[model samples]
Target: MTEQTCGVRDVVDLGQDDGDTAEIHDECGVFGVWAPNRDPARMTYFALRALQHRGQESAGIAVGDGKTVLVRKDLGLVTQVFTEADLAAMPGKVAIGHCRYGTAGAKGWEAAQPHLSTIDDTIIALAHNGTLVNFDSLRRELIEMGIPFRSNTDSEVAAKLIGYFTQRGHRLRSGIAHTMRMIKGGYAMVLARENALYAFRDPHGIRPLVLGKLGENEWVVASETCALDIVGATYVRDVEPGEIIRISDDGMRSERGLPPADRHDCIFEHVYFSRPDSIKDGSSFYLMRHNMGRRLARETPVDADLVISVPDSGTPAAEGYAAELGLPYGTGLIKNRYVARTFIQPTQELRQRGVRLKLNPLPDVVRGKRIVMVDDSIVRGTTSKQIVRMLREAGATEVHVRSASPMVKWPCFYGIDTANQDQLIAANMELKEICSYIEADTLGFLSIEGLLSCVPSGGYCTACFTGDYPVEIPKSFYEEKFLPGYTPHNPDPSASDASISISDIAFDLKESENGD
Candidate 1:
């Protein structure tokens, strides 16, 4: 793979943060295409752009020709990282792509995916969408075995694990199955070798992955249906939990990699993670969020002259809330979308400017009006407080804030980069206290049950809202990291079924080797 040096213009990337904090950050996105005649790299590029809302820090694509796997990746948005010539150079049949927000590792060039690893004389690249809770111990074990590592990332750990097992005489699918059984936490992964592409998901279905059909032989897989739609692929079905599907010249093959546990699809995908156009269980996320707004209005009615939203993300819910309450809906704030990212160091004045760099209120719309602001969710309340102050400065008489989702009191262990329990505003403050902190005249958050009612019916991971984790985290890890008052609840006592000891895995591998 060739690395091209490109210069970035001098500006501040709001994403990198100039000391101001965002309410919530996004997780990662992954996509894969197994199209022979078509331009797989270009298709992946467009798909990554479609799924860009899922991540913004970095983007990468790996193309697997019949001879070798070639990758082009860097720390920037998809548009910034790739030129037309870059995609033209990588001609291949099978490909996988990733956009990263970096919840599991450092936000550096090395941490970008599709993470490359070698098995015997062959090469493979893996793109992952979620976090692996047990990766730290697994990395240490591999290190002691003399396996070299390039980055401290869960994705790298996974790539190495597959290579480790494959080098032990197992087939690539077997290696993937073994790795799936061993790794813990929520993940949706796409792996590509010289001629084949593989897609798999965690047992609990805590993350999302979908299968799509392009033509007779071509196939596509992605973290969301929106990516598939962008590439003209028709959605087939979700890549079933704990299942692995491999596509190649031999056609597609599916196998149970791990026994499916209780389905705990991430509810936040409907709340904020997935794109508005993305489909989940026969409904669009935009529709779901709009429903959430209607439910919120019924649960907590507010008397305000106008209803507005934080911006693009919260607009659907804001409209729904306004329609349901018979209140006027207007654009009280304008967002500077181009100001999403920058690298320039913030001076003290710029730090004080904060959210104004990204958002500004329109005095004509909000002046002398009682404004009700709707947002998807609030994490640290930093942005919310700043926005409230901005509205007041724009001549808003009284500001009321509403969250479409329930209070995010517990930190996420899946893919989302959430604050710790102590840093979470809701976890530290009660309703009135939080309202005062944000300087909102009034504040209301949708109830957990109310939120569930708005989405398509299925088991959901409400850990961030309810502290009920579908997969069990080690008590020691939580005890050492989190505050004493916060304890995660696992609904099923039997959920730790996949917590097999490393000795057991070794014994299992040895038995299989002897059988062969």
Candidate 2:
């Protein structure tokens, strides 16, 4: 194992124009490979780079040789964390990798994964994506049972839980199944041992996990297809909800860890988290976003001479909007792609110049133009406000702001790190008030129905937009966080066992340990 350090820096991407707030962040990305003849560690590094958009705070890889497990991780972007020497030193047949943007733990070296733990006599490393809501109580129970912990992350809790169960006489897959039934919330996890790889997902399927074929016997699993493409693998299928897939010299096997619940895939993947080149639900994210823009234009038409996007994230939608209305489409702003992170602390005066550091207006494209600026979503409205002002100052005659998705009014508990309700500008301000706040001549958000129509047909957890959650949240976890008069809708109360007693759980484990 090896570790390195640097000051904790905030990564600015997507709609984080001001750099003060990242409107939203997917929890992390996970990738694992089971290819004996291949350079699995190098494959994992390339895969993590492909999934880098999902996380930027940390990157790590754990490789399992025939005899032991080795891990190298640190707090930084993937490019900064590992080098050719590091990868060349760790030769292994199986490996799991992680890139994290923490939504459930502190931003420290210990919180970065793939988290290492021991299961009886063997070493195992686990990489996880998504937040586990009931982890605090689980952590306490494990601690009471003499289990030690090094970090406050739910990922570590999951690792220790699997270790605890496996130490008690059950097979590793059975232990994983037991852990799956206990933890609640959205998650997709990949675990690596000395000679094998295992991948699993939550019952509700709130997070994504896909399996791919490297050749014949070699198999790989990752958070997105783009990762598979980067590693020269062929898409196989999604690891179904509540399913456990194990790959090794034994080939591949799958079984139900828990009965699959109603699907509640995160809809925000289409909005921002996924790269445009990524494929989801039989369509490229680019096509889905393009359809969203077309739907948004029909629903909220504005008088404008040109249509522009918040660069990169919003480009597809803006192009579709221009095509639908026969309006001219041009690049009004150019982004400084090099501005991924800053090492120096930003002063209050420097903070005011935040948006300018990442994006600049092209006067030639927007001058004398009545511009409609399209963005993926508006959470706090700070970035949108700065971008709008920048366009106006660049000689735009009038500026109208359009959000491609519905207003994000509620906090997300699945995996996305959204602001508190009071901090969410859309939750507090009316449409007109938000328009005034951002200093735009007009502002419009796509309706929930309109937004859903643009994506593939499936159940989605739109909790951030409509306060509808697929899994039940513990009252203790969210009672104080929800705004007054807002009732969270949990469609299926029977789906979650978060309130299950710890004593009953302990007793069950004891019975299993005794071969009852």
Candidate 3:
């Protein structure tokens, strides 16, 4: 066990560049276990570290020892919290863990999860991934019923609701079923009790939850398949929408409940949210993104000397695009492997600064050449503009931007942290306008058909791009303002108050009823 104390400043010093950025949405990762031969907490810690890219705000683990549950959580990176000694202290064979990025809760220790509850003389610990559109209404109802709340998180409501039902003489699975019926929006949950571990996904499957096997007696549930791979587990299948699976010493059992009339797995999981190595619903994420880049190159051809990727996630797709266009592929940008994800930064200033410190353009390769920069997507245009400016300053003759996914026009009510519609540059601007704003010579985005074709399984949720939600979304759904010390800057006085509230917008179209 290596014992070393390193702070955020020390980590920042290890960054690779000075000025380059990318727009992205923040997400959470969840992992759990039922029965295992080894200490489940240590395995979960490694799994969370593998999924640290999906979230960075906090990391936690809850373990069950057949009679009691023990939990440990804190606000920081996973590596910072779970040391070898910490792992050794957490003794258990069944555990559930979480890596959170605050979709709808305060960014403090209280909101960090694996929320524990004692109801009906049984300890239940929960770790959730996804956002609930009806959180406000649910909170009000729970408060009215005299349920003492400990944290300002939407996930807690689900835990309390399930506890409430279980206390009324309902079976554990029945309580979860009843709670699921009342919730509205996306969720992939892991529920732990004295002797069992349970996993479930929302009816619409807006979020992801996959099942894997470690050994003959051990079963695992994780937000992405990459986690399972890191722990030497074999991918079994995804937890079906509206289905609950229980794992105990006896073995694994499943119950199929009422599924939503529609199914829409989050498309961003393939584009930017998930690790490229992960396999979602039997579809290779790397291949899907690579195919998207290939299609983008065909639809919007650009005369460029070379194609360069933004690094990490963009590298695979850029290679595909270059192959399709017969252009020389070069490493134009170098990423700082040690830099933390900017989207996970709690403050706006920190997010902006993090991006600048994350990536740098390689002047030798891009200088005196026409560069086609391939990236996954652009959200607010802040990162895109900065990256374009960096390339030009680095002596690139012309910079052409290519996006592997369609433009994001609508705020996601499922789980992603895309709250304000106005903040989205693509939502209000045309393609030419967006290109001009980003100062790019040319800009191209993947078409809807191209995105759908990329997926081998032929099912995805592109609601953020096309406004086609798979379930009945709340008209008033919006991300809850929960970051403790963070606040938005007020708009200029001279500007008109064109901001629209959630209730006024008619989000549901007639096509939503058709369940496409």
Candidate 4:
């Protein structure tokens, strides 16, 4: 395997606007291709490059040459992990790739995915883009059967389930179908076995996944349509929640794993996760963000001379706010894109210097004037405080901070990186307290109503704001979900092994690894 590094001076992690404090991240991205007579691995590489915004810590691509599954993954950006020669060496008819931020499990080379496992002889490689809430339950169940796991990642748990089910006389479809029911929480996954590519989503469709046509019969499945665009594929449609699609040289066949239920696709995609050029749930990403900024302006108008963004993610919202309020918009913060994830553990001094390292206030824009700052969300309140201080230091007479989305007060167990609610400033502080905490003259957030006005309410997950989870999470799971190093024990320790039956988990292998 070859490793490469292009001379990219500045590479920042994507989908994280909250700086320093509780860097809210989208978590992971998955991409795959099924193209006969073509180098599927190469296409997957490029597609993963486009979806890199979704993940940054590690990358891998697995290719199936109709007989053997080959995998290479390590902790790094896509560009740093794979070279052109590496892609050329793993030529195959089908390929699946992953860029990981690790929503669940520890971060390491061992945990980096496109997790490869053998379904007896038919090798399968899988990439995942979400967390599984039933992790402890499933792990303990499998452990009871003496089935050991290879990694700490929940994706490995999924791979083990597939391998076990396939080994137990279930067809690839049936195996995946059963596995889907056993798993819970948000996920968009791509798996390749022997000769076919399979993609599926959570029953609630808590994460985004879309299908696209490359040329003629060749197809693509990915976490976002933006990946499809990068690979020169024509967008098809989103994979229906709880639906499974298997792609091969013959064609594509689909089946449902779970019946259509209350759709709860993550609302964060339109708010901040996706690229503005991309589309989600038939809505334009740019328009959604623009409309959010529009609603934010109307709902939370502040007296200020000019509007400015917190650099990149906040740009569209700042522009919309400026236009809506009839105030001039200007670039008050200059971002140095080259400075990305630093290796050193930031000291308190270094952390305090965080804003200057990435963003420098353009004094000329804010000098002796009132300024309005528009940002996506406030996570820990530290970043907002730093930003307000930066603006004040730049000669702004007053600073008003406006957030496009409602305050994120709850932990997102679906796929977001927020681990504990205790870290959320909104979860703890009132608006006036938050304003004082951030050191801003005023602070306002778009109401849930105002935020929903920007997009259709149906199928959108607003559990972060409303706390009404579409899928019921066991109360046993919450405190353990974010509290690090917590061990799992039955709520009733008196429970017997008979509590979870393995009678349905058979061990026979006589079905096709693919539909073929």
The alpha-carbon lDDT assigned to residue 200 of candidate 1 equals 97
What would the per-residue lDDT of candidate 3 be over residues 291-384, giving only the tens digit for each residue? 8878878777778999998878887789889989899999888888887733344577655554457789989999999999998887877777
Report the alpha-carbon TM-score of model 3 versus the true structure: 0.86
lDDT agreement with native, every candidate:
0.86, 0.86, 0.78, 0.80
User: What is the clash count of model 1?
Assistant: 3
For candidate 1, write residues 1-516 as lDDT tens digits: 122111111111111111112746656999999999999999999999998888888999999999999999998899999999999999999999999999887889999999999987789999999988778888888898798999999999999999987776468998898888778889999999989999999988999999999999899999999999999999999999999999999999999999998899998898988889999879999999998888788777778999999988898899889999999999999999887544566898988888888899999999999999999988888899899888999999888888888888898888888736777887887666677678777778888888998988888999998888887776544554566777788555355645575446657777889997
**Off by more than 4 A, model 3:** 1-22, 341-354, 478-516
List where candidate 1 sits over 4 angstroms from the true fold.
1-21, 491-504
Clash totals for all candidate models: 3, 0, 0, 4
Cα deviation of 66, candidate 2, in Å: 1.5
Clashing pairs in 1: 12-342, 13-341, 13-342
How far out, in Å, is residue 92 in model 1? 0.4
Query: Candidate 4: which pairs clash?
Result: 10-338, 167-508, 168-508, 169-508
Query: Can you give the TM-score per candidate against the true fold?
Result: 0.94, 0.94, 0.86, 0.89
Tens digits of per-residue lDDT, candidate 2, 73-166, equal: 9988899999999999989999999999998878899999999999867999999999998888888988887889999999999999888777
lDDT of 4 at 414: 79
